[model samples]
Target: MLFAVEVAIALFVRDRFVRPYLGDVLAVVLVYCGLRAVLPLRVLPAAVLAFAIGALIEFGQAVNLLDLIGLRGNPVIAVVLGGSFEWLDFVAYAAGALLALAAERFIHR
Candidate 1:
């Protein structure tokens, strides 16, 4: 359910002002994973799951899978995934993940 919301936000809000902030997506994923850690899950497993979800999103963009649901082509996702190789997206993802980690720490404290 959370994952579905993430994907829905990605598809619908990608073109909004936050479109360039891929970090926001990563941060959201991290927060979700962090909160889920309240269960018996380990951190590495949670991070891997988040990464896998991100990878799946990138692949979906690459294959235009979202188009089936009326999402227009977004060259940004391709670039973020290294098709065109924009370093900024990487930084954004890192920042987002770090922010999430920090937030998790604060919350857990």
Candidate 2:
């Protein structure tokens, strides 16, 4: 279900708001859910891992890893790895992690 939402957002949403912030947020949520699907982890750990991975990806953008790896010409890889770095992406990732944690708690209760 969540994976579907992530795919929908990836394919459909392209406006400024969705592209810049919501994409980053949903990216983290997808990561969180993906990790949960694979491992038996507490909510906090899953969220932390998601956020950490997101941060690392953003850091990779700062260093232009995609260009170094010659994936800059690939649109799919460009979207997945991101071509540029932004501080707001970190905030969006954190927000997504918190939302994932809250949603998990709400659903469990």
Candidate 1 residue-wise lDDT, 1-109, digit = tens: 6455545555676563365565445544655575566766565455545555555555565666656555445555533342322334545555555555576678789
TM-score of each: 0.47, 0.91
* lDDT, residue 72, model 2: 94
Best by TM-score: 2
Q: Backbone clashes in each candidate structure, one number apiece?
A: 0, 0
**Which lDDT values do the candidates have, in the order given?**
0.53, 0.90
Candidate 2 TM-score, C-alpha based: 0.91
Measured with C-alpha atoms, the lDDT of residue 76 in candidate 1 is 55
Q: Each candidate: RMSD to true structure? A: 6.7, 1.3
Worst 10 residues of 1 by lDDT: 78-87
